[model samples]
Target: MRTFRLYGGFLGAAEVMTKPVGLTAAWWQVLGAVLREPLPVSGIAREMSLTRQSVQRIADLLVERGLAEYLPNPAHKRAKLLRPTGEGYSAVRRLTAAQHAFTNRVSSRVDVDELRTTLAVMERLIAALDEEGL
Candidate 1:
């Protein structure tokens, strides 16, 4: 219950922070997932732990909004690679800056080593849950 509440809080905060960049939390998530390189919707979905159908819809919307584009995939005939557009990069930059500012503010009041330990614990919990197929 506490974990759910914490996640909810993060989502609410993300929505507010990402709005100025003309993005929703979902859109920001999609853009962030593809930051390193172009990927098929399925790949994006896998990496982000989201459903492929939902990602497809978001990818289509991003293309319509001129934030992402579909390029021919040499590896797969039907699966086009979704690449971020210039606008997408700009939006990501803004989102990153906002994230950095928030992190900086929080870091000043938190212990960095404790934060690392908390992250490790969370990762271990997730791994354990995954092993149980939860």
Candidate 2:
């Protein structure tokens, strides 16, 4: 369907943006979760519904780039809590601002309530897919 094609193309564009930033969608997702709180590797993996190994790799990359740091975790003997460094927080803030600006620009041409309703529908659809094991 044309709608599916458009949605796929939008995802492709998102991938292109991440490519230049040395991040994949998975990495962004992990980083976003880390931004909320310092989480152990297993916690991050579980929150993102990703394999621990995959989350670990992304966390390593983030640490290497000075975007994140590992802190001592009292609760876990072997696992360290992950937290965003100053640079990481700044980067995420900028990225969020850009996304907000883009959304505002796009919404300028459409009714705000319509966009909100559409997003709600999309959220429900995504939830249904998850429930169906998609």
How well does each candidate superpose onto the true structure, as a TM-score? Answer: 0.90, 0.69
Let me know the TM-score candidate 1 reaches against the reference structure.
Answer: 0.90
The per-residue C-alpha lDDT of model 2 at residue 60 equals 91
| lDDT values, one for every candidate | 0.91, 0.78
lDDT of 1 by residue, 66-114 (tens): 9999999999999999999999999989887788887788677879898
Candidate 1 clashing pairs? none
TM-score of 2: 0.69
Q: Which residue runs does candidate 2 get wrong by more than 4 Å?
A: 1-26, 122-134
117 Cα displacement, candidate 1 (Å): 0.6
- Give the number of the best model, judged by TM-score: 1
Expressed as tens digits, the lDDT of each residue in 15-133 for candidate 2 is 65556565655556777898878999899987666789989998999999888899999998889999988877766665665567655776799998998898999889878977986
Backbone clashes counted, model 2 = 0
Residue 85 displacement (Å), model 2: 0.7
Judge candidate 1 at residue 116 and give its lDDT: 93
